[model samples]
Target chain A: MINYKTVNDNKCLVIEISEDFIIDNSDNIKLKDAINKIESLPEIAEIDFDTTALKSWDSSILTFLNHIKSHCLKHNIAFIKDSLPGGVQRLIALAEAVPERKGVRKTEVNRSYLASSVAAIGEKVVNFTKTSKDMLAFLGETTIAFARLITGRYKIRGSILMPIIRECSVDALPIVSLISCLVGLILAFVGAVQLVIFGAQIYVASLVGIAMIRVMGAVMAGVIMAGRTGAAFAAQLGTMEVNEEIDALKTLGISPVEFLVLPRVLALSIIMPLLCVYADLMGILGGMIVGVFMLDLNVMEYYNMTRDSVSLNSFWIGIFQSFVFGILVALAGCLRGMQCKRSASAVGEAATAAVVTGIVAIVVATAVITVLCNVMGI
Target chain B: MLWGFKHLDIKTASITLKNLTEREIGDIKVPPDLTVKNLPDSMKTPHIIVKNITMAYGDLVIQQNLDFTVNKGDIFIIMGGSGCGKSTLLRHLVGLQKPAKGDIIYNVLSKNSDLEQNRQKEINFWNTSAEEQRLLMKNFGILYQSGALWSSMTLAENIALPLEAYTDLSSSQIMELASLKLALVGLAGFEGYYPSEISGGMRKRAGLARAMALDPDFLFFDEPSAGLDPVSARLLDDLILELRQSFGSTIVVVTHELASMFAIGTNSVFLDPVTKTMIAHGDPKYLLESSKDERVINFLTRGEGKQIV
Candidate 1:
């Protein structure tokens, strides 16, 4: 319990803290009330602690005392703690021994909602312009690195290239296969449901084939690689930056773009189309499984229909989209990583940003290619 | 056949007896007429022996043929010119970077243990398995130049992390120990603050608190005073000396501060960037007074033209 009474003709306020003044007790309201009473008294010249009845205490009691101490300091009231226990006095002394460091606390500002919104929008616009400029700079650097690689100037070691190739291509197979096959199966089943009613169930093969070959397969692979390899590249490069390994490479006159980014870009670009083709085959096979078992169509008949429905133009477009997606994912990941601040948390933010950027780029590229294909009658 | 066996003190005799059981007394070879009076009052125990380590980063040799010994309970300073691989050598000693050639041997025997146990207990740091290396690393407390605290955790949580991982103490007990460690570094009430919330000097002190969390035997500090003002830097030097006096921990500090070197360093190795090797090794004060190497004198006096007398 906490109780306070004014003495010396209301000139001094004495606070009494008694039994079980620990953190567990719900006596905060009492403390707050006492503080309010002390604040209201204008003529009070001093505040004192009367702890003769105090039996037990902890950090909670210290915190309570600290609140009053701050209030007394603010009001220039003399704080007398002579009645408190020796241990409590010493703890209070220890806590105040190192003064609260100047300019360490973050200053909070209150602003109108409209003003805050305008400020936020201004910050976003500035950030967007900065990000765009950085992206263009990274793009130019990558182009130069590519030119050097083509002209027999920059040689990428097999040690670095091989691991990245394996990571984005071979290691990505299981997830890509699963997602593409599921997309094909869902397409086949949904088509079969409607075609069955119209007595055209065999059309499910063509429906699944055209969709998978033209876009679904590559899209699924792109999303999977974005989440897997893109995030990984960001995390790897971001950690290298944090460890000053990238700076070390720079100090040695080796361009990080050429040594680090080029290998990753080459690996991802070369593997994405191959993975996309493999994903197309897996998706067609998944469609066949549905057509043969679920729709009772002959396996060879379904395969022949798929071959007929998937045009060369659609297949080439899908490959091209996947290649572009690969380059985009790699660039996005590396760009975010290179831009990362030297902190542990920044690595995580970079990885997340890489995934988001990769996925968004894939979807936008898909949209533009679709519109172009329609306009050109592909 | 045991020449000094008769004059061996009780402690030394017991150690000799312990070794005698391991090896035949006839196999024990003692120097002629070696007596307690002639023997060293206390032998310097080699805690770490760097044997001809050549540090390199892919074809670029930073330092070569580097050999030194860090003795037990010694504040060993690794001082050199900027970019002379002083921090690199500390990294090698702490097992962060591998040496291009030779080995780093750690003597695992306690300071007061028998001298005969040195060879038997010696461990090749690089040759150990990953698990063994991790166990060895547990005894080391490293303070990086940037005070690399886990930015996400509060000072108390950062100090409590190793305790939580390696000990079975309750949460409250760990927190209390964390507070105690913070208090030792004069950051008593700043336990709830994050690393970014404090000043640079405070962050360094907090880093020291985290380093001492497990009460490690070896404390390695990289640039303990690089970013601090003179007053805080001096206070830190005093804190380091106090830590050594109280805990008797072997300290390896990578610093170029002449004041710090003379103030606390018991022994040191002067690394030469030009030669890519150490040019001098001994007590820093003694080296300052007696070393004939011009580079050593130039470095020790901060190139202010104080030649050896």
Candidate 2:
């Protein structure tokens, strides 16, 4: 066991610890409790340990000595270890050899809500600035890549581009068509309520046609593609980053943007308008279905009204919006992928961030384009 | 588990119900570590026996009819050119892969399980129960090539995880032991740093610290110097030597790094792809000086061993 003596009102506390200070023995229990008790007393100005009897100790004696050392360091108590074995002394010295490095530990202390909020806002502003700079740099690189493509200097492997094109276009068609169709149907139904009150049920077709052709079809498709294709792109490139393939490309003197990003972006941009036209067709059909079945309008009449109401100008506007959104989604996904850290979980985080960024870019582009469309009298 | 196990019939031995305490096991005198080239001594004292092992995938035999012995406290190297089933053999040794034909036996000298009586009946690789496997595993510690430290935890936390899972130590005690292990690996002040924050060499050392956390008797290193610089690799070699000196734990390293192979290796097995079995088996240094196989010579000397000097 363990023996302790209190001299001069605990100013000089002597702890004598002995043989086989293992956890299995009942000695560890008493020593553990005594160590904690001795450690807490502020009045104990000095601590001395006797460990010559520690014939075979595992973590128990080490734990006890560590406590005594740290307690002495904390309370400015003089720790005398002349009575301890050389090996135990050396072990203690080894464990305490390096004082903890400064600022390595993440310290979190309670702070006022206002203070924390201000700090958070400041951090957000810094992060926003950094992201803006990164986006601009990415755009510059993309512009250079596009210039190289126009000059026919950049290599575009048909194999890589073809699959991406199919995924972003053919693979995305069903969901995009379904969401756009539902959007058109909802628009028709809501417009029918007001149009019916005014005895102008035919104008409901114009409302559905204009809304779906101008913005609804493109926006719905944009959201769908952002969640589907953009996230896939990010995950793919993020995995490439993890495997150091992107670095390998750079080492081989081929720009990752020119080799990997350009093909994907170009494919998305090319297929986007085509998909929008398809979305527009699907949306008009959905509206036609809703009108003929729910509004007692004849199918031929509904078809004629839709054909008359939707202008080529509105269709072109929707196509242009979709093209821009496709570019933004590709850019957002690629940028996030390039920014991915070299770790397995970073790939997943990059994919999630890509989806968020893609949708945000689409929404923000929609707002800007809508204003520009209005001003330009599109 | 203690080490001097006697084989009765080389087949099976009944588990004796003697309650052998840790103190009693510790009192058993371990045979002094001698030169591994002593055949009779080593044959009688095989710490781990790879008996008639045949590693395969489907119909493809990676290596067949492989047999080897690793003695106690030996720094054993499993050396081969890339893709010669060296790692496959290591996987079999560590209980990760099942041998298509044979079983690996660890002759843990434990009295309670009557482990010594039947030549490793307690931990008969594929035949033993899951609990028996876990018990056998407690005596082992493996360090992967990538230093596979948990990315999320701090260095100290990663080291403390095994301690927390297996031991009854308090939080403060665990932290202290973690620091101790880290200090042992020359990573004293890096307790709070994440694996990502440290250099690749430091990460490997931290992994070593974690492996040594349970104070395991069998320590394994897989390509420990695969990605390390020369200085760091040499430092790792020194660390391995020190670990053997201090703890005297049996070390099994899987590497083809020649400098490391000749430096710390007390015994080694050379796996050849063409032969699809061990071409050479003996002490690495002894094989380097005496072995006559051309392939083995080419491998040992980094070129043609016969031609070089």
Pick the DockQ winner: 1
How far off is residue B281 in model 2, in Å?
35
Q: TM-score per candidate, in order?
A: 0.58, 0.51
DockQ of each: 0.02, 0.01
Docking class of 1: incorrect
Docking class of 2: incorrect
Candidate 2 residue B269 C-alpha distance from true site, Å: 31
Query: Model 2 reaches what TM-score against the true structure?
Result: 0.51
Query: Tens digit of lDDT per residue, candidate 1, span A265-299?
Result: 99998999999999898898888889999989998
Which digits, one per residue and each the tens of the lDDT, describe model 2 over residues B177-232? 99999999999999999988999889899989988998877888889999999999
Expressed as tens digits, the lDDT of each residue in A287-351 for candidate 2 is 88788888888888888888898889988899999999889889888999999997999999999
Model 1's chain A TM-score stands at: 0.91
Alpha-carbon RMSD, candidate 1:
18.8
Using lDDT, give the best candidate's number. 1
Residue B15 displacement in candidate 1 (angstroms): 57
